[model samples]
Target: MFKLKRKIMSKLYTDIFDLATAKVYAVGRRSVWRDYFDLYFILKNNYIGLDESLLMTETRYGSVFSQKLFMEQLAYFGDIKDFSIEYGLGQKKIDLDEVKSYLLKVVKNYSQSHV
Candidate 1:
């Protein structure tokens, strides 16, 4: 049981990350989106808390990584496996291409030093 669970992160965390952190400020808040489908990328490779693992947060805000910078770091994990855009009540079209590869890489690279 422990070994099985160890390899799995959890869909629950993915949902929270998408709901709480998925947004773009490249221009403004109105344009950014965090739809449900996009959570797959974050969940698949465990990027939910990559910044914390990497110790990339800024001292002033006490945040390991910003939304934009996070995705920037997500490029190292692998490649764009899958993606989708959702539109509905409280839903926005989220993109998930290439995020898994980058995030998995971050976890592998950083989890070691932190532990």
Candidate 2:
């Protein structure tokens, strides 16, 4: 039981970080739509602060995360529109454009503050 509890705790910590930190980092390097959706959901739900999330990401990944690259990826969603994936929050459906616009706003705010 102690071993099982430790395993669960380890996974829980990983999930908590992955929810925002890993997703945000992945968005900069890949066009995975799930990364964007997860980020939108995390931010909209107040799961974590963006600055804190980035800090955790940097802690985990060191200097691999570039703020410039992340901001650029967040702003560019042209290719994402061509790809489709089912998305929703609970029973309600979510639109891709809405996610894009919301994240764009977040990127804008983050950029302005960091600059």
Best by TM-score: 2
**Predicted structure 2, TM vs. truth:** 0.78
User: Lowest summed lDDT over 10 consecutive residues: which window, candidate 2?
Assistant: 80-89
lDDT of 2 by residue, 12-85 (tens): 86787777888889988988888888888888887787888888888888888886788799789876644456
TM-score each candidate: 0.25, 0.78
RMSD to native for every prediction? 14.3, 3.6
Per-model C-alpha lDDT, please?
0.41, 0.83
Over 1-115, each residue of candidate 1 has an lDDT whose tens digit, in order, gives 9866754656655544443354211211232223222333444445555453223233323443364454443433233333434557885444354444444555466556557
Candidate number of the best lDDT: 2
Clashing residue pairs in candidate 2 (N, C-alpha, C atoms within 3 angstroms): none
Question: Distance (Å) between predicted and true CA of 63, model 2?
Answer: 1.7
Q: Which regions of candidate 1 fall more than 4 Å away from where they truly are?
A: 1-56, 63-97
